[model samples]
Target: MIIVPASADTERGRPGTTQQFADMQAYNDQMLRAGVFVDGQGLHPTSRGARVTWADGEWSVTDGPFAEAKELIAGFTIIEVSSREEAIEWLKKWPASCAPDPGQHLELRQVYAPEDFGEEFTAELREREEQMREEAARAAARG
Candidate 1:
């Protein structure tokens, strides 16, 4: 996940520039060519973000930019790699996408697939996933 670290823009707007946009596309192209890229995104600044919480049979709403700098995730990138070490190496290659002023950060995270759910996932679940994947492939081929 790419985290836009806290700065003045948290409240009203997000960060962007033509140079950074070009840089991101360049980096994404590299990853796509390598076949490790799954998906990625950029988020609007916090002020346009929201939080939903539930407790005591009630729900609460909070708008961003949230004050807690560390908690916010500005964007995310999903990739498939052989190992955490490999992911780290790929993440390390992220081009500096920030403007000279507002800083940028990236967090590499392991996404849990059904296998991570252990025994509870069951053979039926695996079969369903496999069937879906096949369907998607067929649809893609048709398109």
Candidate 2:
């Protein structure tokens, strides 16, 4: 996952400024051509979202408009890649015009897939996942 923090929001939707969108489109095209673009989208401000936390064996929900600008994630992009080095290379090429600082941070995080759990994930579960993969393949073919 690639995380865009505060700076992204500051540069968006201004008049006479469209290079950001074009740069993003170019990056998306490059990633797509490389077969690494799995999914990505920008997020709305914290005012439109909420957080549900589970603690003390109870559920608590907090409304947003969160105070911490640095903590709020502006967006995320998920990619399929062969190695961390490759991911880094891709991120290094990100356009400067897309954020307020003209080269704001983009965080790279490794996501845990079910297979990462090793033996704790039973064979039955693996079989179910394979079936689901097959179903997804079939659905894609239908389209």
| Residue ranges of candidate 1 with Cα displaced over 4 Å | 1-7, 99-105, 126-143
In terms of lDDT, model 2 sits at: 0.77
| Number of colliding residue pairs in each model | 0, 0
Model 1: ten consecutive residues of lowest lDDT: 1-10
Task: Give the Cα lDDT of each candidate.
Answer: 0.72, 0.77
TM-score, per-candidate, Cα-based = 0.75, 0.78
Model 1, residue 141: displacement in angstroms?
12
Q: Write the per-residue lDDT of candidate 1 for residues 5-111, one digit (tens) a residue.
A: 44455334545667877887888899899998888876677777789999889999997667766566666778888888888887777767553234445666687
Q: Write the per-residue lDDT of candidate 2 for residues 1-143, one digit (tens) a residue.
A: 88877543532422124777788888888999999998778777777778899999999999876777667677778889999999999888776666535344678999888889899899999899889989999998999
Residue 33 CA displacement from its true place in model 2, Å: 0.9
